[model samples]
Every structure is written in C-alpha cells, then in structure tokens.
Target: MQQRDSIVETRSFDHVPESERHGTVRTQVQFWFMVNATLITLFTGAVGPAMGLGLSWTLLAVVLGSVFGTLFQAFHGAQGPHMGLPQMIQSRVQFGSRGAVLPLAAATIVQFGFAIFFIQTASSSLAAITVDQIGLYDVLIGAVAVVLAIVGYNLLLRVEKFASYITLANLVLVTLAAVVVLPIGTMINNSAFEPVAFLAQFGAAATYQIAIAPIVSDYTRYLPSRTKGRAVSAAVFGGTLVSALWLESLGAALAIAMPDSDVITAIHDMGDSFGYGIGSVTMAVAVVACLITCSLSFYSGSVSFLSALEAFRTMKSTGKVRSVTIAIGGVIVIAGTLLLPADFLGAFTAFLSILGYFLIPWTAVNLTDYYIVRRGRYSITDILKPDGGIYGRWGVPGMISYALGFIAMVPFFSTAIYAGPVATALGGADIAFAVGLGISSCTYLLLTRRRDFSGEFDAVRAAPLNTLGEPQRSASASTDSMEGNIPV
Candidate 1:
C-alpha cells in the first residue's frame, strides 16, 4: 500500500494500481457519516414541515426517502475498488469514452451546485454565530475548502474520520435536548397529512441522498480491489442513512417548534435554551461539517471536469490540472453564494427537485449497466482510448435510454418554477424521479439485449497500457509514470 502521509494526492482520472490501494471500508462509513451530518441535510428535513406535512408524516418521509435513495447511491461505492477509477470516468463503459462527456458535464454542474449550496448555508451559519459579514465569511470558507480539496484523498479521509466523532457527539446531544425541550409531541398529535406534501418531501429527502451518487466513488477508488462489495455498500448505506435521519428528524422538529426562524436560528435558539455555550458550539460544528462537504464537492467536481476534458483530447492527469480546476470552481461557488436569493429554502427545494430530474435517469442507467449487463467487466485501456476502444465512440444504448428516461419524467416534475400538467392534476405531487428510474433501467436493458461483450472481456484480460500506448510497467517500477505519479 502507498504511504497515506502524502500531503497532496498525485493521481486523478487515472487507474489506481494495487500497490497504491489503501484504506479500509470503515473509512467509507466515517467519511459519509460526517458528510451527511450537516446543515444542508437539516434543511432538507425541514422541507417536509415547510410543505405543510406534520412532524409524524415528515419523519415518515425522511425514513422512506433516505432508505430508498441510499440503496441506489451505496451500490456505486462497489464500482470504485473494482474499476480503480473515479466514478464519472467509469461511465465510459456505458456511455463510451467521448459520449460520457454528457454525463460528466452534468455531474460537474451537480458538484458545483452542491458546493454553492453548502457554502451559502455555511456562510449564513458563521455570520449568525460570530461575524456579521456574510460576504467575508463566504470568501474565507471557500478559500479554505479549495485548499483542502487541492490536498486531495488521504487528507480528506483523515479530516472526515476526525469530524465523524465530533458531528456524532453533537447530534446526539442536540437530539436529546430537542426531545426534552421542543413541542414535538404536540406537533405530532395535531398532524394533518397531505399526500402532495408527503410525496414532495419524500422526493426531496430521496434526492438529497441520491445527489451523492456521482461522487461517492471518488473517495472510495483508492481502496484495495479485494475489498468486499457488500461490505463497502453496507458501510456507505448505514453511515449516510443514520446521520441523515438523525439530523433530518431534528430539523423537522425544529421547523415545527420554531416556524418563523431559519434552520440556523432554530438550532442556535434550541442550544441556547439549555443555557451553556452549547449554541455556539453547535453552530461552529455545523459550519465545520459544511466546509468539509464543500471541499468534497470541489474535489469531485474537478475530477469530473478533467474527465470531460480528456474525452476531447489526451492530457496528463497532473497535480496542476486538479488545482486549476478546483480553483476555478471555487470562484464560481463563492460568487453564487453572495448572489443567493432571499427565499433560500424555496430556492433550495427547487434546486433539489431539478437535480433529481437530471440525475435519476443517469443513475438508473449507470447502475443497471454496472450490475446487470456488464457485471463489473470493463477495460481500463479501452475506457482511456481517445476515440474509444471496444466500447466505440458513442454508446447509442445509454445515450438514447438516458434521453428517453429524462423525457418520460417531464409531465411529473413539480417545482415553483414550473409544475407539469400531470403534477398539477395530481395536486402538485412530483413523482418524476421514480418514473425516470424505471424508464432508464428498462430501456437500457432492452436496448443492450442483443449486444455482445465478448470482445470487451477479451480486452479486459489483455495487458493494460498507459495513455502513451506503451505497455504498462509494474506499479513499483512505474511509480513516477504519468498514471502512477505518487509522490514519495
């Protein structure tokens, strides 16, 4: 295993060799647990009560949505170790080398969008806790997050592992305090469930979890190939689900008890009600968690952007490339945070809904291709081919299925900007994600039925080559090669 003490990760958009693979499945648990236990997820939970669902119904939505969404997202973790490549790059198998630019671009936008949201919320929390200068906080937080992203994988793991303990402890204490002090019981007893609100909240919760799919593997790709798929999937699913539920449930209760205040204010007021410096501590922890998640977004966004660039031309995956992309993305995130609209919660809900529309179909097609049709068989050499190797220049099946699935969801989309006719008729309940997932999966399966993979499997068995088309050397001898640029 390579030394984990390297300050900056050297590899990006390249296959991790067995010699470089390190880390245990437990790290996956810690990383995701910390990632989800943040202000963003708490806001997601608050969406239920904001939409008029009672506390009981909101909790139901949170549980159901987290379970359903995390199941699909967790399976993607297995692909990282098996392929030894970043998540979006692996899409080349289904979408073809160049054809994958479509999904890569979409994934990049999602990552950047997420970074903007995290920074926006964190800036607000920081301003509320200490400084009143939201703009200054935005720049400071964005700069710090970009630096962490530049340092890359190993450092992210260490930071998240340490953060997992702090976040978990804070959440447990807050949950207990809310239970004893809030009017959660009254909110539950006076509950009036609306189907539209229930479904909308459910969709929001599910998509909040699903949004992690495109980037989940970026953090896990360094794990040794022998890591069990089930073990990785279980760790990811359990950790994310637990943190999301704990925070979201508390968020729902907070919304019920303090409807006029924002999530940050509500959390701060709740902590202060206990009469120690707990309010400041909780706000500080929330900001720290948000910053960590923002760094994750920038890191994965850079990798996805580079993967798109590679589809157009061959380029070395150097540290310089990663740094440039992250720096550029960080600039956009900071600007967006400053210009955010007044209705933060409403805008955020719409953003999540739109995210689901774009991502659900892609996830469905990618997962179906990985688990069913291809069954973990792929060629690193062909996937890196400029013109695409055995997979061809464009995967007609995947592209067509993705488009068809996206089109199928149009009538069911519900948001403040536009409510589709079907959604309006159903009293504004959005079930577009479900429809997209079903259509994308079945369409891709049918389209690829007669396709043959014998040649692809043969290519997989052949000796892999680096981007220069030379036979690859052993990981130990090629430690300084463009593909194996691990710093000593």
Candidate 2:
C-alpha cells in the first residue's frame, strides 16, 4: 500500500503529494452531500416558488438546474487530485497566478456570504428551542463550526461523512413531513409553468450549487492522481444531486403548503407532526445540520481567504491560522447577518443571484480551459511560487474573457436589486447564467483555437509532489512555459 502523505494535510498552497492523496471517492460523496444538505438549501429551495414559480414547476426547475450546475461542480471536484491544488490555484492556469486572485476574492465573498446565510437561517429556526436566547444560539453554532473547521480537513471530512449518513436518514422525517403536507399527486398533476419564475428559480438553484465551484478542489485534492475523474465526478454529483433534490423539493413543498410559515414555524410544524422520540431526533438533526452548514462555508472560506492573499503566504498554509481566520470570518458573517438590510430569505436570494452571475463565466472558462483546451495538463509546480508560474502574471485572454462575460450578463441579469434591460425585455426572465457561460466559454475557445496546432502541449505537465516552493523545474517548464507569447 502507498504511504500516507501526512497524518494531517500540512501544506495548503502547494500541490498535495501522492502519499497525501489517500482518500477514497466516497469522501467526495459524503463531504459535498453534507455540504449541500442543510437548512439554507431548504430556504433556497423555497425561494423559487416564492419568486412566483408554481410548486410543481419550481420543483422541476430545481432538479434541472441542480443537475446542470453540478456538472461544473463535479468537473471541478475531479481536478483536486490531478492538480493537487485548490480550485482557484488551478485557475491560475487559465487566469494567471496574480489574475487568479479575482476569482479567489469573489469565492471568499461567496463562502462568507453562504456562511452568513446559514447562520441566520439556523438561528431563526432555533428560536423555539432557545426561547429568546437567539444570539447565544447563533454564537454557539458559529463557534462550533469554527472549531470544526479549525480542526482542519480530515475532521471536516469525517464529520461530513457522519453527518451525511445521519442527515440522509433524518431527512426521511423531513421528507415524511413534506408528503403529509403536500402530496405526490399535487406535485405531478399541477402544470402551471411560469417561464419567468421558472427561470429565476432555475438560476437561483443553479447558482446555489455552482457557488461552490471555486472551492470544489479543496476537499477533492486529497485523492490519488490516478483516481478516475469519472469516479470523483460521479461521487460528487450523486451525493450533491440527491441531497439537494430532497431538501430543495421539501422546502418548496412546505413553502407552498404553508405560504405564511416562518423558519421556526416550519420546524415546529414538522416536529409536531412526529410528536414521539422521532420528533426530538428530527429537531436534533436540524441543529446538527446548522453546524454542518456553517462548518463547510467557514472551512472553505478560511482556506480561500488564506490562499488568495500573498501576505498570508508566510503563514503556514495548513493548520496554524486556518481556524483563526475562520473564527474571525464567522464572527463577521454573523454580525453582518444581523445588521443586513432585509429578512433572511430576501437577503440570501439576492446574494445567491449576484454570486451566480460572477461564478458562471469563471467556471465555464476554467472547465473549458482545463478539459477541452488543455485536456487537464497543467504546470502544477509553477503554480506554487508566484514569481513566474507557467500561467504568467496575467493572461489577457482570461482577464478579458472574464470581464467580457460579466459585462455580457449585465443586460441579461435579473435580480431584486436590478433587472437588466434585456431581462426586462424578456419579461424578467434571468438568462444571464446561460449567456455568461456560453459567451465566456466560446470566447475562450476561440482565443485559444491555435492550441491544436501550437506546441502548447509541450508546456502542459504535472509538477513533482511536495516541491511547491522550489524553482519551476518540471518538464513543462523547459518549454516557453509563460503564456506571454500566446497570441490573443
């Protein structure tokens, strides 16, 4: 058997070594399953219908959107082992090392925003149990999550695996509650498809899944390099798809059934339905689910923040300050949630909508650049030391393409804050995601069209394990590794 990398993952910014790449595909399945199976998703699930989509149509929209979005998330998940770097670090290949910071910062916000949303949702739901001690409840959940994240990657995976198993079973109670409130027949036969609402619902659902794109590789990077991409991708998609569909559908069902139900009311209603021991278990799962939700968001956010800024490079990338960063970030998110402008659902929906637009094109470009353009080969070692990674300081095409994608979405965007002119023309339908994905991907494809004839493959190779900070000496570095000469 191959030796393990370390008892714990010590190096954060560099390529994870082969010995360290000891996790199974099941890890990917469980980590992301627990990541998505949370109370906030249930809230996200309800937003689509609240936006005016019919329950039946909203459910379909959620499924279709989640499946399509997870395609990107799963693809990103597979890169973990191959590149042995964080997802944004691999992005340095598409957008140069320095250029990579844009997505990194954006992802930081996305993660922080999500952690905030989960805290607010969880705290609100616990009002019945805590009876007026809501602040204590919020702080306690956030504190536990920070501690879990501080314990670092292995513990995060372990907790998530356990959480996934328990949540899956406990979700049955939530599912049963849903069926009792809204029957299967009602979901299937009612066909009131509002296109605008359906599209918004789809965008929101897709955004929720895709927002994880920036950090997908964080958990997956521990797998062996030879691990089949299909396995990694399948594990993530299956777990995430099933969990999201269940909670999202459940949320939509309850929202439709009790249009006036608050977060606490929803939980109380479910618990009341199963008044025996099962009721207490259901309640406990809700609380645990809250910790799981914040743990992941804060965990990913902490890593993303540490890796994005060069100032933190001197600090040990792994265990040292990760928890500290997460704790500080958690407090900020909690404070912001309380001080924010609107209700939890309102603020969160807007946050998701805004984040989705930024993420769509970036994921599109990163995936296209890796799988299609470069066929997954990258200058792994060069990505470590920022002096002169094979990606160079900036790739005009990537930076320009990212901006163009964002600009293209302006007229196509649909949100509570602002609806673009095109979105207004389309009767408020939000097709920004589709437009941004296609435009950024097509633009990137066209710009790099010469790769088929160019000797670009000469510069595409993996770095040696644990050789992060050393000079770039991989086989790929022998070629003109810098992308400066690649004509746009």
In TM-score terms, which candidate is top?
1
lDDT (C-alpha, whole model) for all candidates: 0.82, 0.72
Compute each candidate's TM-score over C-alphas.
0.92, 0.88
TM-score of 2: 0.88
Which prediction has the highest lDDT against the true structure? Answer: 1
Model 2, 411-452: lDDT tens digits are 988778788999998777677887888889999998988656
Q: Cα deviation in Å at residue 83, candidate 2?
A: 1.1
Superposed model 1: Cα runs more than 4 Å off: 1-5, 339-345, 348-352, 463-488
